[model samples]
Target: MLSLTDVDKVYLTENEAVQAVSSINLTVENGEFVSFIGPSGCGKTTVLSLIAGLFNPTSGKILMDNKEITGPTEKTGYMLQEDYLFPWLTIQKNIELGLIITNLYNEQTKKDAMTLLSDLGLDDKANAFPSELSGGMRQRAALVRMLAPKPSLLLLDEPFSALDYQTKLKLEDLVFSTLKQQNKTAILVTHDLSEAIAMSDRIFLFSSRPGTIYRVFDVPAEFKDKLPLEVRNDPNFHLFFQTVWKELEKVENQNSNTS
Candidate 1:
């Protein structure tokens, strides 16, 4: 449902222009879960910003459902590394903020939002402040807030990075099931290879800066029906992980040599 064609992003400094990404062409089908992984400074986040319409590409175009994305649209939701919840607002209000901002705040929407909050096991925490919740709970609340607006596309930028390993794994399972249940299309940017392998239907490996698609790895068919945590226990999990890890190592080595 989303595609980027020959996209290029260049930042102009006083002295010279630096290209952040080059010749990026990719498509994400409706309800597909894709992950983008690469070495640091490879512009994964830049591509995300372009898709979110936070910045315009220097060339080419990005389309969602065949319509060009020129600016931010309510149909897309972005969940970042940090929860970014307003400390003063209670959980219920924070989750409804998006709906309120979009002028979609009404009894039904509010109820639906509350229902989602409850589904994520945050029902009792609705009256709590951000500072009162643990990091994992806060992130789960963030997910509720993001989903409350009912966005068709989700852009997750290292949303689990800061959490402990156990929390991260648990959140991964929750997000995987929730998105699948809702049939929402998602693109995740993460440095964690195993996380990418377990959670994605496909993984896009990018090259070093002035990043371009280096390789695309399709997750094994057997893993598709499993949740993120379950996928990790499959016999072939480590095999696929090793393959991606080797390729990522190559990408990093190439960057070092070039530098």
Candidate 2:
């Protein structure tokens, strides 16, 4: 449903232009969950911003649902490192933020927010403020808010990094299932190789800064049907993890030597 062709991004300072990504060509199929894994300073997040139309690309193009992306569209939902919940607003109101922004807010939209909270077991906390809930609950509430608008594509940017390990793992399943149930396409950018391996149908490995596609690995057929935790516990988990880890190490080392 989304594709990037020969994409490149550059940032200009007073002195010189810095290239962030180079020739990033990618395609994410409808309802597919894809993850981008790379070292720090790589252009993974840049690619997401391009897809989200947060800014224009320096070269090449990004297409969504067969249309070229020009600017941010309501069909995409973004979840970042922090929940970004409004402390003054109740969870229910926060969940409806997208609807309100789109001028789509109405009684049914409010009910839909509540329904999402209820389904996610956050209904009990719907009336609570952000400061009143634990981090995990707040993040779950954030997910409800992101999903409230029924976006077709979800862009996740290391969203679980601040959470504890158990909570992170739990939310992984929650997010994976939620997207599947809603039939939403997703693109995740993460430094966590294991997280990417466990959650993605396919993982896109990127090179160091001025990032380009290094390799695209499809999860083994046997593990494709498994959930995150199940995949994590499987024997091949180590193998997949180690393979990516070694690849990342190689990328880093090669860059270091060249630089």
Candidate 3:
């Protein structure tokens, strides 16, 4: 339901201009999970911000459904690396914060928020403050807060990177299942090759700074219906990883040659 065409972003300083993203064209179909993977400073997050209208592009346009996105649209929800929960507010209150800000407060909104919290297994923790919850719980709460608004699109920026490996794996499954259940269209920015392959229906591999789509691949069958662990165990998993790794290497090598 989201489309970006020939998008470009440039950051200017006194001495030089840094092109963070270049000619990025992408389309996310309804209910599709698409992940953008690249090395650090490759503008993955920049792409997310552009889609969210946190910043306008230097060139080209972004559209959701058919309307051009001018600024942050209510039809989209964003989750970042940090949970960013208010320390003082309880889980329930935190989730309610979005509803209140959007003026969506009402009986139905509250009921939906509570139902989301319960589904994420945070029903009892609803009364607990952010300080009292574990990292995973906090992340789950953060996601609940974002999804409670029922936005048409979800933007996730390394949402699982802060957790330990085991927790990350579990949360990946949790997030994957949750999104599938909610039937939400999502675009995820991540550096982890395995994580991207495990959760995404399609993966976009981006080049380094002045990021552009270097390659795109449809995830294999092993990952289509299986858990993250199962996907990792598949023999072709390493092959796919190596393939993406080499594509990234080519970008670095080409940049070096030009420099």
Candidate 4:
């Protein structure tokens, strides 16, 4: 399980100090998927970074399975909007990179990574370089690399934002199913509301600047078992989207007023 208690973060620059997030308290159960959404500059990514242990919180604490997260650990993996795969490396090398860095490399780890590549339909591209694959395929390769280490918690920072609409939808289903099958806990920071509603067990909505949890929307139980694409087609999807949309609009409007 992952827990954040009254977490606050402050950034200092030559000019002044900025509070990015404040009073954040939440918990994510094992194998649960959660998404954070709000207007730009609401510190959604800051919260994710704190969870990833990229930096420590200025106040309070973040714990994973009762242990504090002081720095990046092997228990968590991060994926971003860009694939960040090395251009000179073949897909196979890219996939094995994480395992090598974490001292997890071995014949068995290689086999498992290859199996995941095959599962994502990238087995044939093992010998290919990043430039040889499409954006979507490279992202899939990146996913394989991230999963190769078998991290229990995955931090996804708009991993699908750069893909085309169709590719985004397809990848969403693939990722949702893959994580569920592996029983991985994931925290996604996305600007897309429909994407959030479709892929998340719960959505954390944040207030404007110096972000705080504005609300938490629990996905309907009926949609839990459905893939993201199927969730979009469900009648209940729009109902829930509208509910979150109204709240998000309020957040955006508040930001405008304060600005």
Candidate 5:
């Protein structure tokens, strides 16, 4: 339920102006999981910041549920690559932080937080500090904190990049199941093609700097119902990966030639 129309973001410097994103238009429907994929410096994270209302676009508009996003809204939740848990806070308190910030804490909030931790298989670690948990557990705990506030829209910026391959796969399933059960609208920025295909209903491919939508792919049927690992084994998985890889190569070549 988020839409961006003809969005552009430009940054000013002492010598010149840098355009990070240009003429980017995108729509994410309710209950849909969308992922943006591109090479480094493609402005994918810029788009997420704009959607989160962390900053205003230089031009165009971003709408959430038909209303313009003026500034950071409570209706949006953001999870970053790092868990960013307060080292001093226990897992239960970390989740509670969201509720506390929103001025919504109560006995029911505590109950819900515990239930979410349990669902994510972090129940045993609820009393553990961030320093005591593994990377994957910390990420899960961060996600639980983000979702605890029950925001309608979730923005994830490469939330799994730090984990090992096996942990990443398991976390992907955990995130997928959690989002489905909650019916949250999600937009994730990821470098992993397989992760995007396995997790997103639609994948948006972006060009390099001054990024714009280069291509959009609706993942094939084989991947539509499989786990991230299972999707890797699908015959067409390699085909999809090759296609996107080539598209990214084209951008690299174009940038090199222009430079």
Candidate 6:
């Protein structure tokens, strides 16, 4: 569980302070999957960094469970647009990176890593270096590395952005299913409206730079049984997409006029 109360983030330099996020209030339930979708430089990723305690908010507070998040903790796992896997490392070693960091590696930790790769259909490639893997495979390996720590929360920052459309869809399905199976809470920051709709139980729309919470949309249950790609063809999908698109456009236009 996580809560952000009127959170604001400002970056200070020698010259001036730049506000990146403003007036954000949000609560994500345990085991929930949420996404933030908005225009570029709108602070979606900044908000995520706040949650991970990568950056402290300039004002207000971010709480995990009942306590404030001061800095990075084992409770969170972060996956970025770049896989960030070390090319020299084999897939298995890369997957073990998280465990090794926490000094929690053991027979069982090794076993868990092995079983996770096996379940993800990457068992045979465990000995292969990152350079030997395809883009999708490397990303999958990255996900496995993040999941290895057994974090209660997962922060996804455009995790599939660099992949081809077909590969992106497959990874979306895999990641969603894996998160559900692992019962991990997630907050995703994505530019893609459909990706947000297909993956999130709730979607938060943010405004332009110095981002503010523009609106929040709850994904309908009609497509609950469908995967991301399958949900795409569902009639409700297009309808909901249109509604979300309008809200985004409206906010963008408002931002444009004021600027």
RMSD per prediction, one decimal?
0.9, 1.1, 1.5, 0.7, 1.4, 1.1
lDDT of 1 by residue, 1-259 (tens): 9999999999999999989999999999999999999998999999999999998999998999999999988899999999999999999999889999877889999999999999999999999999999999999999999988899999999999999999999999999999999999999999999899999999999997689999999999899879999999988999989998999999999999999
189-216 per-residue lDDT for model 4 (tens digits): 9999999989999999999678999999
Q: Clashing residue pairs, candidate 5?
A: none
Residue-pair clashes, model 3: 0
Residue 232's lDDT in candidate 2: 92
Q: Pick the candidate with the highest lDDT.
A: 4
CA lDDT, every model vs. true structure: 0.94, 0.88, 0.88, 0.95, 0.89, 0.91
Please tell me which model should have the higher TM-score, number 2 or number 4.
Answer: 4
Best by TM-score: 4
- Candidate 5: regions farther than 4 A off: none
Q: What TM-score does candidate 6 reach?
A: 0.97
Model 5: per-residue Cα lDDT over 68-169, one tens digit each? 998976699999999999999999999999999977789997798899999888899999999999999999999989988889999999999989989999
TM-scores of the models, in the given order?
0.98, 0.97, 0.95, 0.99, 0.95, 0.97
**Backbone clashes in model 6:** 0
lDDT of 3 by residue, 74-154 (tens): 689999897999998998999999888777878998999999899889999999999999999999999999987888899
> In lDDT terms, how accurate is model 6?
0.91
- The list of candidate 1 runs beyond 4 A from truth reads none
State the lDDT at 191 in candidate 3: 83
TM-score between model 4 and native: 0.99
- Which has the higher lDDT value, candidate number 1 or candidate number 4? 4
Q: Single out the weakest 10-residue window by summed lDDT for candidate 3.
A: 221-230
